[model samples]
Target chain A: MTADRPRTSLLGTTALLFEAPGETTLETQRRIWAVAHEAAGFPGVREAVPGMNNLMLVFVEPPRRPEEIEQRLLELWNVVAPLPIAGRCIDLPVAYGGEAGPHMADVIEHTGMSVDEIVERHSAPTYIVFALGSHPGYCYLGGMDARIATPRRKVPVLKIPRGAVSIGGSQTGVSASDGPSGWNTIGSTQIAFFDVNRSPPALLQPGDSIRFKVARVLR
Target chain B: MIKILSVGALATVQDLGRTGGLSLGVGTSGAMDPLALAAGNILLRNQENTAAVEVPVFPFKVRFERSTVFAVTGADCAGRLDEAPVLPWWAHRAEAGQVLSLSHPKQTTWRATRAYLCIADGVDVPAVLGSRSTQLRGSFGGYEGRPLRDGDELPTGRSNGRAVPGFGLVPPGLALPLEADGVPAVRVLPAAEYDCFTNSSQDALWSTGWKITAQSDRYGYRLSGRELNPLRPLELRSHGIVPGVIQVPHGGQPIIQMRDAQPSGGYPKIGTVIEADLWRLGQAPIGSNVRFIRCSWDEALGASADIRRWLANSRRLVELHCGERGGR
Candidate 1:
């Protein structure tokens, strides 16, 4: 798919940012991945981190000639194609509402849907992983049905448990560890999002897809 | 090995941090003053990335379990070995059962809050995700995944007996200075959302004096300065962020993310402190004022090169001094 002109900016001396097209879109993210893949090959490149629609290039050794890197990135974006959605599919079993879902009532009140309807709507769509941020192994996902969309909590909770599935400002994510969050939680999964013992500790990666299954429900 | 007799506030094991893990939502949690960490390691002839005990709050006391060479870097904390005075930034040898103590720092040439206790061959800790630095939020890595406390025992990496005592190198802060128009300042490069801020906000960011607030820690520094208002209300998505990014939230005060900051944030980033200048920010004491100097990409890279040059020179000097002693 054709994308808008990729916007390039310097994060600092050691890091570079390339923003693709507009807002959160799969096409733009795919373009970002394409650029990220290409930028990773550049000299002095240390890490190529992808976001919702942006790619961050971190260099251990700052290139003496930065324009060369920028030019190369621009050139790559010109010939960019959608990166293949190639990753493992993971099934996340969620227990919706009650103690497991601390903020499920808030979500139901905001969406004005029956608890069962909300669960059906949430579990139906197979969300696409946009990026990982906020915490270790926390996946920022897209493709949530608009019917269940809810704004974030005004005052964030101090400590949300790990594996808590949440929604915040049109996006859905799972807590990687026990930490504070602003997202309204509706359910939680028992699976670990991060394990220090594992290689690439995060369970999900960009381009991976996740399907939520209702394991149980609590009133 | 060493046993903690008394842990003064916050003390954790840190190296250069886990760098390649940000993509997986893991933050780079390392030494706040990496220059000190590097210099301490160099004094002991240890690897640059070797883990060291980062002691922020002082009045700390530890007892060596065996004979070992060590160095204390960063703040001049008036350290002592069983009541005998030990110089800051100098390498020293201690015997088994000898206790080392550090008191409140006496700021002389540099205003630094943290001090690093570096032992030869680095601290003996299992590297988590390729680093020994403590990730406090996740509660893993370093010594038992937490700060050192009384009775905590820390092992030492095996040294090659090449480290020498009674020698020292100048602190990197004194060796490489960063200033702007006579004011100690850190260079900053504008970030992606720089233009979203108001003209006054930008001007104040560059021109005003920002006092590091008490709320500051390894996670970030909350600076009390001229209010930085954005041009409009921006609803930003959570995005990738690195340490040194200066972000402004609804309160108008700007916060500079530090080594332990989260990997991503939704705040509007006005500027990013140059990577080379981060050490200066790390040493800036709470309640102390600091200024921001706008610099170009090339200048920022040049600063990094300067740090490399400094490190290389220090390494060579230490090697020469230790080599002459013939592996004492």
Candidate 2:
């Protein structure tokens, strides 16, 4: 599907932003990826980073006129199609409940689903990786069952461990590193999300897919 | 080689920063005051991107294992080499086994924090992902991926012996002189979400002075100033953010992302402190109040050009000074 006219603006003197039409949807993200991939080849364009319903164009040789780049991006957005590519499937092992899932009880209280029911619903869908942001290798996944959605904690936890599988207001994903977070930690995973030594440090990419499997229950 | 005698609060080896990696979700981690790093390198006739020790805390002590020429730039932390006072921003040679101690930063001609200790050869830490800078968040790169501590021996690169002792260039702050409205301020360009805030919020951003809270660090500068209320409550999705983007969170206070900030954030960005003036903000001490001046796109780029011109001119003068045989 062709994208609507994006709201173009300068991110700063260095980069320009193009906000795609519609909310954070798979179609919008796919279109953003297509344009971002194409924009990378544009003159003076250093990197084109895809965000939730937006595309940030970082310039290496920041153009004399930023508006020119904005105009070009606007043109690309209106004409670019959803160029879908084959993505790899990776299963992440999770230990749910108890200490492993420190806030699993909170999810239960909010969703009104038993531990077994929540786990089954959450792990059933093959979630699409929409984007990576907030933290390194922190996947922004799509396809979570709305029934399992939970609001972010009022106060963020100071030091959440790496590979933390959590839910935050209609979204569920894994944390790549040990850092502060506001997501309700309902489970923990064993997958290594980031490693600097690796070519692509983040184990998951924008086009990848993820499935969660119940490894064991933590007491 | 250099042996860390007694490290105070924090000291880390830093270079220009790890760029071209934001796509991999890795933020650029590097020296806070990049101009200081570049100036120190120029004085020692070393590559501009050479790694140097960025000492934030005071009373830091170190002993050189071998005789080497070095330069200390940035803050005027009263420095001494084996009981003899060594002027900051000047290149000096230290004898083997001699100790170098940097005391608390004194309020001098310039009020600033953090100092750069640059050796003749760059710090010989193995570069991770094409950079020697320490990425604190990921726990990788630069001297075992951590801060320097007492008794830590760091390796140094091979020097070409072109560096001359007993001379230094003027501090870049004096030479470059970046300010707005006659006070210590940084120039800013309107960002993507500039129009999202209320008119009063926009007015306060350009007019009111913001104090740099003690909570500031390499990741970001948390500023305390007038509460910036948006036209309406706006919840933005996490997007790609660069250093110097002024993000206002729920508290209405602004936080300017720095070199080590995460690659992305969800806070509403009212403006971006231009890349040229980021060095000025880097030198701004905690508890200091700074103002922001709004500028057009061309003006922001012009500021960056001014920086490049200053660097080029400074390098030429230093080269000519070092080329002389009997230079003071």
Model 2 per-residue lDDT at A142: 80
Per-residue lDDT of B104-187 in model 2, one digit per residue for the tens?
A: 888666767889999987898999887999887778888888888888999998874877888877786777675556668988
Q: After superposition, how far is residue A8 of candidate 1 from its true place, in Å?
A: 1.3
Give the DockQ (2 decimals) of all models. 0.45, 0.46
Best by lDDT: 1
Scored by lDDT, model 2 comes in at 0.83
Tell me the tens digit of each residue's lDDT in model 1 across A41-137: 8778998888777778888777787778778888888888878677778898999999999899999899899889989999998888888877788
- Candidate that would win on DockQ: 2
lDDT of each: 0.85, 0.83
Candidate 2: residue A74 lDDT (0-100): 81
Clash list (residue pairs), candidate 1: none
Off by over 4 Å in 2: A1-4, A95-124, A145-157, A168-170, A182-184, A214-219, B178-183, B326-328
Best by TM-score: 2
Clash pairs detected, candidate 2: none
